[model samples]
Target: MKKLNVTEIQEKPEGFVASVKEELNVELARTLKAGNRMLVDSDGLAFIYIIEDELDYYYVSFGKGTWPSLKKLLANQGSLDLELGNSLNIELTAIADELAFLTENIEGNSNYGEEMEKAVSDIFL
Candidate 1:
């Protein structure tokens, strides 16, 4: 959650490493302990923070550039697939289910039901 300025990042280049060390308190044996180069795709329109641990590679997104790239990639495959929409719908459904369960649990249980209802309504709205 630490917001680093671009100049600070550019000056150190290892700013993320330092941030990680300070935040996570991990002492790396060597600088190479940090794996994979940070990449900014096209003028900082999109950036990726990649880390590799053993045979596993993980990427964390800090911005919204991937969506257009993903859409383009999907389109190139020659279909207007609803996969993304479906995934979002599934997640929303899960949230709705959880809200319903919480509502049932709060029924006839003092002010809990009102609070739960308000929270669920706010999220849905």
Candidate 2:
């Protein structure tokens, strides 16, 4: 795997795009820490790789029933009816979701062309 620094990911994420499993899987795993974010995929698996950390990352898999709530909680960065753990976990969750969004949209092709403006219609009301 091509280990990438945060900057490299930010500048050119497309370079890392590949098969979902190959893109999300890591060789080594680590414990989640404060300020650590997750790299998530459509499969509901989340990976963690902090700065200067190994290419492999600590990961957690969520079930279908709960994954959506967790994903939403992280994306919104707000408190929800769901309960997981301490403030640190909540914070980390939020960051993880953000990272997942970035990876999913850029590397996963979840939002391609969504930002582009639509063509004008000649038959406007």
Candidate 3:
């Protein structure tokens, strides 16, 4: 189960690489991050990235409204609601292999122990 990279995900017809240019008027080719999970349904192409512990990010494009780093879908936030959009229909977690790899790689590289130790040492000073 090889983890899918951003380029592969963008190549799909459901992807918004073109839509992003047409809709949002932004070029995303250079800035798009590797997706941890992706899903394509009738609604649109939706993808997710594990930004950090307990912090996840998402983007969905219906050939129209397209945005990234959305905390929650808002009318003004992007153009659709997470619950109402393709996310609900497309389970990102179903990509277990990618999810597992993403979590392990992202979390494994975190310097939580070092940061915590530094915080503790600074607390008494």
Candidate 4:
């Protein structure tokens, strides 16, 4: 599977979450329109979590898929209850290996890393 380099959002937690949603929505639309099946390993989710990890932008607390899942919290408002539990534990693992290529490929060439970062960052801001 190919990897996606998502830009690291250097802003407040809310900013990061909003940015992820916006990026994901756009990418999802584009991917679907292109007739590409969006597997868990697709670039869209990878772009989301990798940026989340790099930013450490979790509002309550930063975890693996905290950013994307938190962004999803609003849509799943009923899921989260008076007490946070399993509902809050959104799985970001599925798409993680997708981004491994971005991190791993840096070993061979520095320019590739720079370009990848730029591509991810340009997804939004």
Clashes of each: 0, 0, 0, 2
TM-scores for every candidate against the unseen true structure: 0.22, 0.31, 0.22, 0.22
TM-score for candidate 4, please give it: 0.22
Q: What are the RMSD figures for all models against the true structure? A: 17.0, 14.0, 15.5, 14.1
Instruction: Indicate the residue-level lDDT of 104 in model 2.
Output: 47
Among all windows of ten consecutive residues in candidate 4, which has the lowest summed lDDT? 32-41
Off by over 4 Å in 1: 1-33, 41-45, 64-125
Report lDDT per candidate.
0.28, 0.30, 0.28, 0.30
lDDT of 3 by residue, 52-117 (tens): 112334353322122222212221222221221222222233233542343343343334344433
Cα lDDT over the full model 4: 0.30
lDDT per residue (tens digit) for residues 45-72 in model 2: 2233332223333333332233344444
Which residue ranges in model 4 land beyond 4 Å of their true spot?
1-87, 112-125
**Which one wins on lDDT?**
2
Which 10-residue window of candidate 3 scores lowest in summed lDDT? 16-25
The positional error of residue 47 in candidate 2, measured at the CA in angstroms, is: 7.0
Q: Whose lDDT is higher: candidate 2's or candidate 3's?
A: 2
